[model samples]
Target: MQQDTVLVVGGGPAGLAAAANVNSAGYKAVVVEKEDVLGGAPILSGYAKLVPSGEWAKDAIGRMVKRVEDDANSTVHKGAKVEKLEGEAGNFTATLTNGESVQAGAVVLATGFTHFDSINKPEWGFGTYEDVLTTTQMEQMVASGKIACPSDGRVPERVCILLCVGSRDRQIGREWCSKICCTVSANLAMEIKEISPETDVFIYYMDIRTFGLYEDKFYWKSQEEFKTKFVKARIAEVTASGDGRLLVKGEDTLVKRPIVIPFDIVVHAIGMDPNADNPEISQVFGVGLEKHGFLERAEQYTNTCGTTRKGIYSCGAAYGPETIDDSIAQGAAAGGRAVADLHALVQKAG
Candidate 1:
């Protein structure tokens, strides 16, 4: 009965979507992002092209940003982290590190995910070999134009793609599937073939998990049309050659023999992690985390975004693995749910 303000935290695709709805419904809502700019991981992501559906993510997020910018009711704060969050349902206050505070009746936490640094997986020879690179590094390089091997400065004669480096592995903390890696790697392989048909491309994966839709088609196309080679195996190690080439050692599990493949460049399709500050976010908002470290929602169907805490909700990778499209969807859903709760409070006040 006091006030109705909903705070949306994070400015990624999901956060942006959530903010749009929160503003449209005439709720006093603000979006708080820790970065200097609004967009979360995708903004800094080096992906050459968007994933699954292959929509340029920058362009997609650009449209979402414009919506937030045009809506006068929506307030966006860049370069700020919620240092403290307090209060209960229909009343919460977020204290920012920059000495600013945002009061709200509800809070939507959309803090996104972070990439696993390739260097952490030393067995991939990421740091030791100049030719070895992470998928992010490859995207950045491809974006820069000439896609040449870092080792020899030549159009790579052969390229090797390793999947599930940080993802789907129990050795690393991330045991669950990151979901997007296989498609992205396959797309990059195709792009490499398109650019230089002469160069050989090999993808070593334990299982080629093309889950649905056009992605499955793309996987098939890579095999039939592009002639991209696939090896169903788990890589053992990557050793560097004196002249900057890389030797990838893995067992072709299907064949039951050790296979050593050499290449001018080696790319590690690294997985994702909860945003580095996930624990901090959990502490600040008083939300619980899943065993896998994502936000644990109160209920799957009824409260897609609402947390165990009364006034706080979570969306996007803060909750778990999601595609750009799903993140946007979840964001919008969270926004509507929070606004509905706040609106009910407003109605009672009236």
Candidate 2:
């Protein structure tokens, strides 16, 4: 069994960053990713631009992937899922679905979150209507450099965006804010307007929860420069017209009246849900889960990366909703901690 190696589950942004740091600290790291690719949702979903910095998502996340791949001490196992996890902190064994096993001194679970399936909300007409799509699907359209209707491939004259599709809704049992949805939605709107300025964009939301200093740069710029209309109301329902257009039914809460708008396409700003693998990973690592189903930290603030089980840590969306920058920072922090712990164990054994 390997003595000083680290097993990093889920080769997303956080996992790749963690592996890079771990390898830099003189420890071998085995990154196990269920998907064939390394960048997780951002890469798999075809995200074009990253928020705030507006850098290409591929370039930003690709650099981290390159760092991991370049490191000789870091090994990436693509298309591999953990089948079984046994042993304790300082010496854990992970068996992959590919019938391979690896032993490590510590474990880092960076399994990222899943997007809220818009299909669950049947009223949104996600799967039913050809023109209705989620933000991820819209990203693909934008990546193609043509924001056109899915039904006929015609340039859409009007586009409607519905925010908070699967988040902050008590009826769906997800009450907490998904954190990044609001900002991402706004960014998507700006992208749409950039590609097609003549296409009028309307964002329907309960509230524009753009946190931090984005008030001037991103959110405000979208409204003022891009002319993206922000509607302060939740969408009641979305119906499809016979001609392939969408009839968005919602209220103008500001004006206290019901408004029905017709658009060529409607985009749902979906939120993040707990990773489907949380339960399996929790059982495998012997870690606890928060009520909301994210990996439980020892403490919310002081111990964001420490799981209930020592030597097994968590970061990124696997821990909670956070930006990519924060996830990278947490990954580095976890890597540093794992190295320190392993060093102490080696010294004690000697």
Among the numbered candidates, top TM-score falls to 2
Which stretches in model 2 have alpha-carbon errors above 4 Å?
Answer: none
lDDT of 1 by residue, 1-350 (tens): 22557788999989999988888787766888888877677766745667666666577677889899788888888898899987878878779988998888888889888888877788889898888888888777766766788866899989888999788877777788887778778887877787778888889998887678745666887877888899988787999766667899989988999988778888898887877888888888888888988888899887777898987888888887777778998999899999898778878876
Candidate 1 segments exceeding 4 Å error: 1-3
Relative to the true structure, how large is the alpha-carbon lDDT of every model? 0.82, 0.86
lDDT by residue (tens digit), candidate 2, 71-166: 999888999988888888788888998999999989988998988999888898899899999999998888889999989988889998899988
TM-score, structure 2 vs. true: 0.96
Best by lDDT: 2
Q: Candidate 1, TM-score vs. the true structure?
A: 0.95
Worst 10 residues of 1 by lDDT: 46-55
- How well does candidate 2 score on lDDT at residue 338? 82
